[model samples]
Target: MKTKLLLLSAISALMFVSSCSSDDDTITPSIPELEALELSNCSSGIAEGETLILENRNNGVDYIINCTYPVNGDLIIDPGVTIQFGTDATIRVYNSGSIQALGTAQNKVVFTGEDKVPGSWKGLYIISSDVKNKIEYATIEYAGAVGDDGAILLWSDTHLKMNNTNITNSQTYGLHANTNNNELILENNTITACKAPMYLDASYVSAISNGSYTGNNTDAIIVDRGFIDEDHTWTKLNVPYHFPNGVDVVAGGNLTVMPGVIMKFGQDSRLFINEGASGPKPSIIAVGTAAEPIVFTSIDNVMSAWRGIYFDSPNALNEIGFATIENASNPDQEGAIETWYGTVLNVHDVTFKDIQNCAIHQYKFPADPDTLTRSNLTYINVANAFCQN
Candidate 1:
């Protein structure tokens, strides 16, 4: 009798295992959507200083971040949560709060508005913050503001980890990082259809290994006054947009521009180094190579002249060999007269020109003599123009 009972049990266990295997094989994964996601109580409308967890995996239901109250703490978004935009609203990471949007490469969280125009909506705004943000595998689009804002307007000191995020249709800038010491590790991102693709104005920051910039009006990469870390490098970063230049290094003091760059300016566009807010000297060491000349041209149509490179900085420039500048509106400015103080200019080898103003002119100080001494210009035009005061 015991042997018979054991045999029956063994048979029952085999049948159960077969049934489980069949169920596993038959189960299919659900498809994702792009609709408004209504979270549970634990993941619902966030109050002031509240931490709401987004726990939905359906992309069809877009998560609405209509929080009337200001966020004060960290809002941790778990992986696999697709928070689509509600109408024309955006997930504003305000105050000292943070949006730790952690997504996988296969599945990225998208935040967009109903309209796809320039002023269609607002995106993650990091205003007056002191927080560390982590946004990976996300798509942000159709966002911009009038007064010093953009799709992802970052102000104050904030550490960010932006990877594989596609930013598009932003009016001002796709990603604008503005501050003194804000560190960002941006990698494998696509920026398109924006005024300025990526605007970096900070110190000790890094953007490595990005794909391309397309359909922009102004500059692809605008590196304003600030220190970019030496270790950072860009590769395969194409600028198919109709911007002024691939990279426009505006007038800022004590900046170190490095090598391994490929630039293409648009029609009638120029790389301008305009005067800064403060009267500090600006400089750029644009060093290119013989085999691979750092190209500067227009995407629209070949023109007689475009501002290939224009330095209006009042700092001493140390131009090394291996750079090739072409198609400029004006040669290096000629020092015809003096008007402002702390204005100095210097150049070498770097060719191409049609300068409209003095290459180097000094603002004569009423009392100081050093102003007159430092205010000078020096030019070496092989095929371009140069100026010295």
Candidate 2:
């Protein structure tokens, strides 16, 4: 009887295993193996005319790269394509390369790391200046390893139009432009889950468009130490522009700050608007609407956190309206603005909030607020002190 029971138990166990195997086969279909693109460290990239199409060939992985992949020619990727990376694996788009990864809303192109965590691999690096280097409707995650500063690093003189891309899970910035010379066109993109949304030169502040720069570890754009040395308009973005260092509007600089634009300056930093003897006069036209006023304040929201704006230009185009200047003016100064001789500043409807002394500090001695504005200037928590001769 014991022998018969043991045989029955073995048969039952075998039947149960067979049922589970049939259910697994029904649930998960057989998928082809992914095409492995074994790339060594800085391998010789693709040449021209030979296109590399990264398609969704297997179960969630189309192409798996072992190391850093270089694109020295045309590299095209279609929708629903998944490109997985190994440790520190990155894709470098070089000067001779052009990548047109056009994905759709429903079927998006994916760039991810094998570990599926932040700092798992190096991110995309675009060093090409090709006009065809564009990427849209894509998702990049688990990038920004220790070797690089950002997940997507754009070198100087590079041109890229990246739209509708979702960048997340980065250990550092989602994007970083090394300098102001790159032609970066960004639109409708969402960058989140990174140290910061981006770190760019002060000259590249206008390259940003309507996108989501918030929802990160720091909801701001790290404006590097640079100057607005050309005529550019800083369009309004959702997050504040955090300036870690001082900036200037030197010769040939005409900066225009649009409505709803927020600028947060570093400690003891100041904005100098000056020009040389014979060049395009430096000017600023910061005209904000009543509904959407512009803001220039301290990054840390501390009292007298920054030095203040200094006007040294004689250009007639210097205009500021419907704005707020706050948390500014160091102990050595007496106002939020320091003006010199021949300076032309047309300021109106501006709310000077949390200022140290007067609203305008005239370098010609005895700071006068009446000399800066015509009317409609409001003050909140201002000391109303005067500068000495």
Candidate 3:
């Protein structure tokens, strides 16, 4: 009887040990101390002329901060706060200090308009401050201006770094820059449907332009008289599109359209240069390459599409080469490109095909030097109806 009792006690002890081991394997240790340090309800609404810091709590609860404030100083917004926009709402980072918005790729913070349209409200405006800012993986849409550039209005010395941000469908211009030596480092951003995607101007005609403005836009990238000292160089920024129906530039100011740049047209969409508008007359010096010629076609059924490209300069001496100008018209005088407004043109090897008006048109200018010079349309072949007026 004693041996049987001892055996039963040994078996019970073994069973208890097995139960303890199983429990240890299944249970997870708690991290209460680390979890206690998370923020909670960090400022629901911000007041006007106030500076604040915002962060999302560690408990996976995002803050829906819907307030438009006029900042007195700097507003430091950390990662994780998903800032939603209300009706006609806007946040102005005033001229007092600056705004530090640092967001990551995977878990980024957003500040967008109420309706996710192209020109919703006025976007984040930074005025007269030494800014060191960062905006990554953010979507700024439906934020537009009426008269000026719509989406973003920037002024003074503001250093901004943007990555993978999107600005779409504002009223006038997508992003406006009217400052001196402000560096705008943009990478992999999309700007669409804005009047002018990127607008650059300067106070007192700037000396050294130190801003890096390069992104994909649906409209023309307009630059005002900011190019004073620095090599006023502009590049054609293109986005990936399946059926490329792209933007056109009708100059509103005195401008220079560079060569070796790609000016692609949408399905049946062409560029128009009218006779003597208000702001400024642009000089397009487009010289495309032989193998990779500058293409102009319609955005829809491209086979038999139609558009127009009119270069109405009183005095234009245009240089041509490896370039294709489709859907253009001839001037009202005898064929031998002449103009009243004297235009400086230098043309080389180029092609004019399938145009609505003239393959090569130069009419008499009303200006002083009313003749075209240094132009080479030698190897150009034009199909369809092209006028040489």
Return the number of clashes found in candidate 3: 44
lDDT of each: 0.55, 0.84, 0.50
Query: In what order do the candidates fall by lDDT, top score first?
Result: 2, 1, 3
lDDT of 3: 0.50
Q: What is the C-alpha lDDT profile of model 3 across 1-389, one tens digit per residue? A: 99999999999999998877864476568754222122222343234455568665554434443445465455676766555555455666655656666666766666656576655566777763454566666656677746435567776776666667666666667677767757776676667666656665522211212223334344444434332222233343442111133222334433333443444334443344443465355544455677655544343423334343435554352344566654333322221222333445555555655444345454443445534554455423344222322
The 10-residue segment of model 3 with minimum total lDDT is: 202-211
lDDT of 1 by residue, 1-389 (tens): 99999999999999998877854476568666545554433333355566767665554544654332244567777666655444345555565577787777876666665565665666677653444578888877777745546788776666677888888888788888757656677888888888878776634224545556777786457655444322233333565223433344443434343454655555445544445565444555555555643444444434333444444455555343444443344333233222245545333344332234433334445565542232122333323232333
- Candidate 3 at residue 218, lDDT? 40
**Which portions of model 1 show Cα errors greater than 4 Å?**
1-50, 66-69, 115-119, 128-131, 145-149, 179-181, 202-209, 223-236, 240-254, 260-283, 295-317, 326-332, 335-349, 353-389
Deviation from native of the Cα of residue 275 in model 1, angstroms: 14
Off by over 4 Å in 2: 1-42, 48-50, 365-371, 385-389
Residue-level error in angstroms, candidate 3, position 339: 7.2
Residue 152, candidate 2: Cα error in Å is 0.3
Better of 2 and 3 by lDDT: 2
